[model samples]
Target: MLIDFLEFMISASNDSYIFLAGISAVIGAILPLSTIIFANFYEKSTVQTNDLYWELKREVNNSKAFIEGFNKIIYLGDNREIFNSTLKLFKLISYILILLWVLVGVGYIANVSKKPLDSFIISCSTLALISLLIYLPRILSRFQRELPIKVENKSCSINEIYNIFDVKGKGEDKLFYEEILVPTLSIVNTNSKLFIRYNQNLPLNNYKVFYSIQNKNKERLFINIGLLIKNKDFKNIHYTIGNEVSNTDTVQNKFSSIPFGIISKFNEIDSKNSFIYILDSLNQILYTGEVKCIFNSETKISKYTIKTYIDKSPNGHISKLLQNNEKEVHLLDDQQKLTPYYLLDYN
Candidate 1:
């Protein structure tokens, strides 16, 4: 009876030991198995992220390059109509391609044969990525890249610009001398020769006279020109403050007041031409050997005088010119000479 009990106890102990060993082995395997699964998830996620980044970057660059190239064609070739048509074609194609990509990616993700939870995760992620893919091109169209996309234009040739800068008139008449004030301060023709200056006591060579004008055909923003002497040129200019304003009504807070008239240095041009000018808002003809001229540009202030020849006046009277309250008005006698006193200011 004792021997039977001992055998039974030994068998029970052995079974218990086996059960404990099996439980310990399963516990040990649980951690490694979980670790392996997590590692695989991380690897897959990393790959997806990398691919997404690269793909987005590539698409962005390609879109910008395409647009930039198209603009170059318009600018350099003067083929703006053709450029717009071609670019519109590409824009349509890209739009169609993006729509198709979204449809496929979304449809596959929604109905694919996979675990419901996994499908949900992948669907959300891919939808986000694909949605970005769909909108990325549109957004990238607005995005300016760091890389400079230079497009040269079919601009007015240097020769043409130079010739215009020479200030030709109805004939090849000489138009300048010492000092000239802006009539209205409008830059009508950038292609033509223009100069704006405040003839202060600065070295002629060192002082940079800043001015700007727009292209008549293009109507671009005001582009600045550097200091030009009797023979100089400017290009690749930037925006800066000046003594004058732009072609538009937006006034420059600095140096707002423009001179009422202009005085020229050339005597020969004055005697020969029937040109009239302003001095302190006074309309005076080029009657003297010292040419007194009125400067004219597109930019107009509140009240001002224009520079041109008016054949009606036998002698352009300085006193008749009254641009604004800023100037004292002078009148003319029946004899067409300067009145003894200014008409408006004597009182």
Candidate 2:
């Protein structure tokens, strides 16, 4: 009976040991699984937070850059139309967002529950739209108020009408000083002979000059010439004109004869009655005047002269002439009474 009791105790102890080992194995598995779940949750939360921070930072940088570009445009007084249009577009988008917010709010209110996916989306969208509408227009309005400062900063203006003359090409054999000044003969028949001058104190770089003529039937003839007037070599822009056509032909073309080729295109569309226009690079007309064709029936030739009277001014004038038709404006030098100012002459 004692031996039987000893075996039973030993079996009970072994049974207890097995139970403890099972409990320890279960605890070991459960602890690692719990730790893994907690770690995953922590990592996901950290990644989401980092993403939100970066997105907010990027949005802030984009806003700052946009404001800077707008300010630069205002300061330069360039591309104002594009800037205004873009600002208006943003304002319109803000208004649209406000409308969307109102619609979403109505949807949320009509549905009594705020726990659905629809509720979450509507809430977030409404918040964002409300924020944009509250601030966009006031910012744009501030920029619009600064338009007067832009206009005040503009200093480029055509001061007066300078010189007007006709350019005539003599045969290669004709003497230089003996070049004839028969204005009546040159003006009536040739488009190659007319020249007009401008007295702009500004450089010719990025300046465009227009030549237009209207016939009796109301047909318009127009020519636009763009100049690259440099400050260092403004008086010697004949080289610039030559450079415009330098790529066309062989080296046989001389500098003095280059004007003829430049005027070749002008002569193709040339007219006796024409107008000269001065414009900024933006095609804004700074000044304009007429070239009148006076026909002499007895001589059977049209005598051409620069029309300076206000009544006879050409169609493209944005400003009036500082001097009248009778006054002569010299260019480059005061004593050099015969320098031709028209592009067709110098070219």
Candidate 3:
């Protein structure tokens, strides 16, 4: 089709307008495809980053849940490796393709234009240079994030959170459950004196804390702050738990211009405590359940977050998920632990 178009364009060869038309046609075809490919590149980066972030987040959260089980989670390093590899692929392929695009733009201009060979070379060279200038940063932009920290055989365990909620289980069930808990969650407010609202039952006496921001008239926002929990006997685990995973279903902020989608519960903390999520979006333990942190590597700072997949209720053939994989956990850690919560802290 490109060739036919090019031929038709060349047939209409009027030195005055042929070059311009050819440039337009070539750009018309290539731009759309390039846009789509670039979008895929962005998507690949996001998906890959989320995989890594959640894995680490889960591992750290689980270890903190129970002090004793931290040792068990260190080995589940599977998804960490997978995400690293996927990210590498995304970077390598993206840069090369972008460079190829510049090359093609230069080549197309040279082929279709009837200018003197010297003039064509000069014009194409300039165009290629411009194209390179535009895409080189694109190739470089993704490199800004440092690669994930290696699981350096050191970790913190909150065995308390793991024991608090039964967050791990079989196969895709666990992963799927986590899908709801985890989100493309990001901190929206960079500067705001904020605090985490806990469900009162959270018993942590020492740890860092933060929470998302809510305004009566704006879209919900996430904010992360660090606070130390030094009072271990504070028995309001329910409030703390609820605070950690509660979907924002309170005072509707009608003062803003942005839309808050479905109560805006995309943010999830990668901890062992099963959050009391009322996926009112679904309604049905299949209705609401806790996010139990199962296991995280005790020996590594790198995470292996896993969850105890649940079916809550008879939502359909959800029960058959366990029978689907090597019998459980589609994505895994280095030690072969399945996702939903980090693995090995299973006390």
Backbone clashes in model 1: 7
Candidate 2's residue-wise lDDT over 126-169, tens digit each? 57657755574564444432222221122212121111112111
* lDDT computed for candidate 2: 0.37
In order, the Cα lDDT scores of the candidates are 0.30, 0.37, 0.33
- Point out the worst 10-residue segment of candidate 1 by lDDT: 338-347
Which candidate leads in lDDT?
A: 2
Candidate 3: residue 95 lDDT (0-100): 57
Model 3 accuracy (lDDT, Cα): 0.33
Runs off by more than 4 Å, candidate 2: 1-75, 112-134, 145-347
How far does residue 204 in candidate 3 sit from its true spot (Å)?
Answer: 18
Give the count of colliding residue pairs in each prediction: 7, 4, 79
In model 3, the runs with Cα more than 4 Å from the true position are 1-118, 130-280, 286-347
Ranking by lDDT: 2, 3, 1
Per-residue lDDT tens digits of candidate 3, residues 42-96?
4555456446444545554453332222222322222333444544554465455
Of the pair 1 and 2, which is ahead by TM-score? 2
